[model samples]
Target chain A: MLFKNLFHHFGRYVIMLGSAFSKPERASMYYKETMRQMNDIGIGSLFIVCLIAIFIGAVTAVQFSYQLDGTLVPVYYIGYVVRDMTIIELAPTFTCLVLAGKVGSNIAAEIGGMRQKEHIDAMEIMGVNTAAYLIMPKVIAALIVIPMLVAVGAFISIIGGYLASVPTGVMADADYIKGLRSFFDPFNVTMMFIKALVFSFILTTVPAYQGYHVRGGSIELGQASTNAVVFSDILILVADYLLAVVLTS
Target chain B: MIRTEDIFKSFDETEVLKGITTEFYKGKTNLIIGRSGAGKTVLLKLLVGLLEPTSGKVWYDDTDFFALDRKQMRNIRMEVGMLFQASALFDSMTVEENIRFPLDMFSTLTLKEKRQQVDKCLERVNLEGANANFPSEISGGMQKRVGIARAIVLDPKYLFCDEPNSGLDPKTSIVIDELIRDITIEKNITTIINTHDMNSVMEIGDNIVLLYQGKLAWRGTNEDVLESDNATLQDFIFASPFLQRLRDAALKRG
Candidate 1:
């Protein structure tokens, strides 16, 4: 029964996506919506994302330095560890996990609210494709903006590690900078962007599907919103594991 | 004319409409009336292509609505306009923006021309100069009027209004009824409304369809209402004792 239900939902999700990516009735209306969503997801989420990235880097450095206290390992190795950790894992995973909570649930709630209020129906009767009008812009905006956010977050995390380690006298500025510059593979940056793009698609389309087909009243809407965030977080983590296996191996 | 041939609709194991066939003519105020759960809303949705019927055909003039592809269906939908019970105005947009949305999407008119058309619609709906107000900021009656303005902004060939007088006062309901009636005749558009408001039934019902227990129980105009002897119609129209007495008194005079 559970497998059947999952398959049923998967089928519906695929069909919904097919309809959502169709040709628009008018190109300019879609462009306007896409720009609005870009501002909302990209610009609106920048500060919170940067704040979280800083804390993740600081905590990782703090914990690693304390653990390396009695070891013969070079103290400057802290910068290397933080840099790789952020680029390969922390930046894409943590930034998307946070966005899954903030933006995913919001997309679900906004679309679900429109469904409940018959705004979608109004658009449909007006000869507008509600799925394309509502979902495509959001997906496009997320795809374009989320990778940039992850890149910015990765840069900020490296700086955060340096500030936490070097300013507190745990390491010299030269040592930290050398550690950051050491053994950096360009492939890791590619992996970061790949994960970011995949995670952004998952977070956006999952929430849009949840919202567009939501039924019932406020309680159901709330449940859909919660499910959007939960499913997006779960998918992001699973994708993280899969990408690590593929990219690393 | 908009016609349905042997329409049947079912949800789950339960059937809601059992072979409903009717005609709503152009330039007429056609009404679908029933008690709650009588499938009035479902039938209205089916008419406007919002929901597909279980096993029947809907003819939008010469077009078989169900036979059309998505693009073709959309072309038919381009000529359709609807007013939801809640108005369904985009709360994020101002009244003028809401009215201009369809124009922006499909019309080739310049911005100034669009604004002029919107102004003309607002004036026709008796809501001039309320263009900047959001739906949430307006009274329920004003919001319904705004909904009417938005519905007719494109001068749709067909109009469907679901419970347009649902939450308004009697006076406001009469005004809304008259406005819809005038628009139907003025534009020569086919208009279908769903309501159980008795006042509305007697006020603007040019062709009334009464559904009961998933079937067509009665059909008539307001003039034929008081004199009709259909048991179900009598039971529904004069369910209250006061209405029964008023009908009795009116019948004696005739």
Candidate 2:
């Protein structure tokens, strides 16, 4: 029964995406909507992304310094550990997980509200492709903007680690700088971007699908919003694990 | 003209609409009236292609609506307009922007021309000079008028209104009904209204289809409603004791 339900939802979700990506009626209208979504999702999320990233980097630095207090591993390794971890996993994963709650729920609620209010029906009868008009711009905006936010997050996280380690006597500035400069593999950045793109797609489209298919009244709408966040976070984690295996191997 | 051929709609295991075949003529106010859960809304949704019939067909004029491809359906939709019960105006946009949405999406008119068209529609709805107010800032009657303006902005050949008087006072409801009636005549468009308001029925109902338990229970005009002998129609139209007394008095006086 569970498997059947899963397949049912999966099939419907695929069909919804098919309609969402279909040819738009007007390119100019879509462009305007995309810009609005970019402003909402990208600019709306900057502060939270930056805040979470800094704390994650700081905690990682503090814990690693404690672990390396009397070890053969040099204290400068804290900088290296923080850099690689932030680049390879923490920045993209953590930031998007937060966004899955913030932006994902908002999208679900907004679109679900529109559905309940019959705004979607009105648009459909006006000859607008509601799925394409409503969902595509959001997906496009997320795809473009999320990666850029993840990049900024990664940079801020490194600075956070530097501040935690060097300014707090956990390590000397010279040693931390040496660790940061050493053993830098560019492939890690590629992995970060891959995760960012996949996570972005998951976060935006999941919520949109939830919203688009919502039924019933305000209670049902709230449920859809919650489902959007939960499903998006789960999918992002699953994709993260899969990408780590594929990209690393 | 819009017609449905044996339209049936089912959800899960329950059938909501059962073989509802009807016609809405051009330049007439065609009303679908029923008690709550009589499938009036479902029938309306099906007629507008919002819900696909389970085992039947809908025809927009001579074209089979369900048989059309996506692009073809969209092209046909360009000639259709719907006024939702809640007005469904985009809350973020002002009245001018809300009415201008359809033109902005589909019309190739320049900005000045679009504004001119918006002004014209607003004036037609008797809502001129109220352009900058958002839907939230307007009364329910004003919102419904704005909804009408938006619906007719594109000069649609088919207009569907879902309970245009749902939340309005009787006077406002009468005004909305008359506005819709005038527009139907002026444009010669096929206008189908889903409503149960008796005032609307008597005032603007050019043709009426009454549904009882998902089936077409009765069909006639306002003139026939008072004289019809159909038990289901009489039971529905005169459900209240006060109305039944009035009906009896009218029959005695006649």
The list of candidate 1 runs beyond 4 A from truth reads B252-254
**Residue A210 miss distance in model 1 (angstroms):** 0.8
| Tens digit per residue, CA lDDT, model 2, A161-197 | 9889888888899998888888999999999999999
Task: Give the CA lDDT, 0 to 100, for residue B62 in model 1.
Answer: 94
lDDT (Cα, tens digit) per residue for candidate 1, span B51-79: 99999999999999999998899888989
Query: Which regions of candidate 2 fall more than 4 Å away from where they truly are?
Result: none
lDDT score of residue A151 within candidate 2: 95
TM-score of 1: 0.98
Per-residue CA lDDT of candidate 1, range A145-231, in tens?
Answer: 999999999999988888899899998999889888888899999999999999999999999999999999999999999999999
Deviation from native of the Cα of residue A25 in model 2, angstroms:
1.1
Count of backbone clashes, every candidate in sequence: 0, 0
